[model samples]
Target: MAVTSEPVLAIDVGGTRMKGSVVDAAGRELHGCTRPTPRADGPDAVVEAVVAFAADLTARAGGVAAAGIVVPGIVDEDSGTAVLSANLGWRDLPMRSVLEARLGVPLAFGQDVRAGGLAEVRLGAARGARDALFVPIGTGIGAAVVLDGRPVSGSGFAGEIGHLVVDAGGAACGCGLRGCLETVASAPAVARRYAARTGRATPVPEIAAAAGRGDDPAAVAVWAEAVDALAGVFATCATLLGPEIVVVGGGLAESGALLLDPLRAALDGRLSFQRRPRVVRAALGDRAGALGAGLMARERLQAGVGSAR
Candidate 1:
């Protein structure tokens, strides 16, 4: 094994695609690419695709010093295993070990949302906050909680706020739970709910636009439900965690003031003595996960762990 200053290979695995980058020690991306995840081909194929992606990235980088890979699901960071991912259809997969063997590089493996949160803390919006929450509400809702400047994993099952019961009688969630926050606040949920109400399938962005324009009463109602649900969740999180800031990311966050203004107002109305966390949009956009993966790889390299086997 040799210690080198070579850039790291970072990969962020999503349900739909896998993003790869060769990132320098400074966390700057040197090269990048994206590939479709072979999820339709089954879990085994997804794993193979990840390995192939890493190997290709390593080669493109002329040899990476280390690698970081983040995926969605119940990821046991300590064990370097992806326990389960309903979207990817995998279970108890030892992703770190497999990638290490296949790529012949030291690897850092973690959950995607957690990685994004870490990235936000280390290099983005939550940089100075010791207590913070990063919630990315995309096709689904997931969160990353940082306490005392470090992410709280709860042994990989910690941040599933999306499944929290915000509306006990609202709607059923994919997690087999009724009235989950995700049912009301997630991007897909907003689109679905709007379609269900209007008998017209409108994308979330369109609904948000309509709400912004104040033209469609149905759109306004749908958006309000999402904002209200989100505010409720934020209030609960504030009561429990006392986060100084809540960084909102993902597709929904793109609505900017359209989402944040109403959310902030609603959240303020709900809080009594709880510290009102400043809710803001994520600074990293869709690249947070990939950048976080890079940061994880660099940290592992600096720690001298995950040495090449």
Candidate 2:
């Protein structure tokens, strides 16, 4: 088979599923697929699934120039290692080496949230911004901090803003912290808190809708708490990072103004002498990670070409 021209495979591994795509040089996805992450099957199985997914995309694309994979956790990008991922049950996994050996292709490995942030800055909501924050609040909350038009990995542990303590005595977090921002502001947390209060298991969007209608006190209260916690976190980030914009993504971001308006107000209220960032919705949606991975793969391909010359 003839090798595909300037096409690369991109994979974004999440706690629930893995998204794969074949993207061309222009950053257009030619093909894409999603598969269960098989977290219950163990971390090793997850790694195998990711490799297999890449191989499948390569075959479908008639072969790719390179591949990029991003996973959650403390990713040592310099060493191409998935240092730790509580959700995926991995630790010290040399994912890049393993995938390179398995697929016989160059691989670019990175942290999922950071990859999404890169996409946001380079191609989406935070484009052209010198400093920005990309926070995606889904089943979990994570952030990507971009400074001076570059994403800061901080040696692989920089952007775990979700674990930042917001409420000292609040809910317990999976990371063994109490009252972490994620426990209150994540999409899952919003649904869980509303369910606990109203004894009705509703999705985050439904809860936001109820709050918008002003018909359910429980929904309104839960949403308010999430907004307050998120605002506090953003205020702290703004004070420290001085990001010009905060691009909110993930499942909760779908709520649009229901989440952003109050969040902006609360964040503004908390700031005394800090740069007030424009809180906006993510433009790339769920595809940010995959596109970012594609960008990484293209970079790897270009590096290889340059080195060969």
Candidate 3:
């Protein structure tokens, strides 16, 4: 019997860290590691780091055929370049070719949220939903709109839900917009705004805990605002996309029902004329992005072999 080999090396690049693993045919991560990104080193240095990360996984896998990299930004998949990434200081960079030659394997790349959404829609939360939205709320909020178990990357920028203006005259955002959803709803926003109000150096987990105890007014208010902002975004997406479910992931989802219960109720309350889909948390842990990257690699491998004939 001929021994078959592993398919691909998956790499996920975030604003602060890098993660990688080798995935088998069954969507299992065979080897994995997480490391902080030396982001200040510019795009060239980042490319080298990505190449090295994928190579390490390939070596550990004993052997792998190809690689996939998921990045946070407006990635022009057709150009195989990162159109721009505000967090990473990237611009029109040819990342795939650089990593391809460096790792000596065929490379597949995609926008991080889109890739993660694909994984969830196909293998995780919204598996059978005809239409779904995968939203990850952390320092920022973004989503992948899944249509028929596949992600729809509109203008390569469709899932930028965080930029939605939930408060027309509220707080200013890094994107130079006022009252953007991220300013009020993201985990960092929840923590920073709470700290600003209470003069306490509390983290997000502590803030959620304080809210639970009913001992912190600022925590409760901030948490509610975050939930409300999220509700606004969900309402808009539901009205527009009509997905069967909204799969929530990222650090904010860690709040469990604290985030979900209110968000679902708020969304449900707002829907007077349209059907409301259930808002649910993603089943995967922090490794969701890396797992999605692995699936992208596997998808690319399948596509390659299919086209070879």
Each candidate: what lDDT? 0.89, 0.88, 0.80
Candidate 3 least-lDDT 10 residues: 300-309
Q: Best TM-score goes to which candidate?
A: 1
Q: Give the top-scoring candidate (lDDT).
A: 1
The local distance difference test score of model 1 is 0.89
Which regions in candidate 1 have their CA more than 4 angstroms from the true location?
1-4, 306-309
Error of 1 at 137 (Å): 0.7
Better of 2 and 3 by TM-score: 2
Residue-wise C-alpha lDDT for candidate 3, range 1-309, written one tens digit per residue: 111246678888988899888887767777788877778998767777777777777888888877788889898655567788766778877776766678777677778898888778777888778799999998889998888777776646678899999999988998999999999988888888998997877879888877777787888899888888888888888889788899999988888887798789888888877768888889876677777777777666667633210
By TM-score, how accurate is candidate 3?
Answer: 0.92
Query: What's model 2's overall lDDT?
Result: 0.88
Q: Which stretches of candidate 3 lie over 4 Å from their true place?
A: 1-5, 213-215, 305-309
TM-score, predicted candidate 1 vs. hidden true structure: 0.95
- Residue 76 C-alpha lDDT in model 1: 84
Ranking the candidates on lDDT from highest down gives: 1, 2, 3
* Deviating ranges (above 4 Å) for candidate 2: 1-5, 305-309
Q: Which clashing pairs does model 2 show?
A: none
lDDT, candidate 2, 1-309, per-residue tens: 223357989999989989999998778899999999999999889888887888788999998888889988899877788889888999988888888889888888898888999999999998899899999998888899999987888778898999999899899888898999999988888888998998898978989998988899999999999999999999989989999999999999999999898899899899998888999999999999989888888777777633210
